[model samples]
Target: MRLRDLAELVRAPAALSVPGDTVAGAAAGGGPGRSTPGLAAASVCLYWGGMAANDWADREVDARERPRRPIPSGRVRPSHALLTAAGLTAAGVGLAALAGGRRALAVAVPLAGAVWAYDVRAKNTAAGPATMAACRGLDVLLGASGGRMRQAVPAALTVAAHTYTVTVLSRREVEGATPALPLTTLAGTVAVAAAAARKGPGALLAAWYAAGYGLAQARAAADPSPERLRAAVGAGITDLPTLQAALAARAGFPAYATAVALAAPLGRRLARKVSPT
Candidate 1:
């Protein structure tokens, strides 16, 4: 397969939305050292691994529903996708262990398992949303591998809650969805943002992020069509970095939060070229 196909398969642009999981976790866990970047790198690897595994697991289904996807389109082999997922998972776990030792591995192991479980086992089941949310929560905990997990818990839960909302919306991307679903998630967006806004001077930025997220979901709630729901799902994925930024800001790392927030526009631009969903 060509590089473009590989990029699509891994949802390369979406990785932009992932690193802040570590940044936020590290900040929340009391400002980690160099290990933070390494953990962030590991988080990205695992995110890509999960993406590949999703494609691999859904290959047969995609053939019927999403035929243009890389695997279903025959641009990439099924075996290659599986191999890619396995290799990336190993790399992610190894990097976590090297950077933060067994503590990091503690979170990384479960995070990796959650990724595989979501893609290979639980994705189509009723537990899919919760499992995927746990993967994201574990990612935050991985950043706290060297420090206090109690402090990181709130931030992890915030990210996980948003992820749960997104995962729920994603399930209806093709078939459309109920207005109640997006409406409920929109209310959650308000609560999560309000909680983040109490963090620090960067609270304004957090509120801004929440407003944008709420408006996007509100559109879907107002008109729950397949196209609108699809747009909402895309918005959820692309806006994730901003939520992470809010968490970082709440953790008193305004600089890191700002850096993460800046990636939001770039993620949106990239999503235009390659779908983040």
Candidate 2:
């Protein structure tokens, strides 16, 4: 499934921190408006790096344990996996091009590489969560680069809070994992939702996304089949983009459109069930 590879390339893990409004800002045009292009690029670069990281390590674990995955399921190959990851780096660069000339490539590009390193190996090591915390810090710094730096402040803070909360959550709530994944991840979902709501209208959307993540994680953790549990948890991981989109829209921009686009039909189908009536 080339589509699956593409999906995997999206980097669900770091999605929340990508700053949807910033992305919206970049896609609409270049240079200062209400957002920072550098930060958005940083966020994208972080996510892309994370995907490559997953492909390198996490994907392998999934393949060995999760034969249903595209790599193990015969839907994709490692070559494709690697390429999918490489594509993210290119995409980031392309986004950077959209960024008006302000932030230095020297700064953005190396940070991107460091982000990749943290994602692929740093995350799994003891230094991993802390490493990501640093990357998140850097992401906000990137966002603040070369523009109305002040405008990026709120989004950057939001991103930092998210990264810190997650790092804390993973370190505490998710240690020595078991079927408790649902409860732990559900809590995480709720926490992130609350974090998103730090603004306003985003609260409702954040809650909605959190609920989705919770339901999915719950369903996965409670699956009748243990084998399915892993798959379910793996599937639940896909919520990263939805969570990010909710934040972008909250941050005040037209990010919802692109966020929805990134989610695909399946997410929309789920939305009918998840959306408040």
Top-scoring candidate (lDDT)? 1
The estimated TM-scores of all candidates read 0.97, 0.59
> What C-alpha lDDT, on a 0 to 100 scale, does residue 269 get in candidate 2?
49
Q: Candidate 2's residue-wise lDDT over 184-275, tens digit each?
A: 55565566667666355456556665665566556655652444443333333344445445555654544453453265335444433322
Estimate the overall C-alpha local distance difference test score of candidate 2: 0.51
- Residues 99-169, model 1: lDDT tens digits: 99989998999999999999999999999999999999999999887889889999999889889988998
How many clashes in each candidate?
Answer: 0, 4
Question: Poorest 10 consecutive residues of model 2 by lDDT?
Answer: 268-277
TM-score of 2: 0.59
In lDDT terms, how accurate is model 1?
0.88
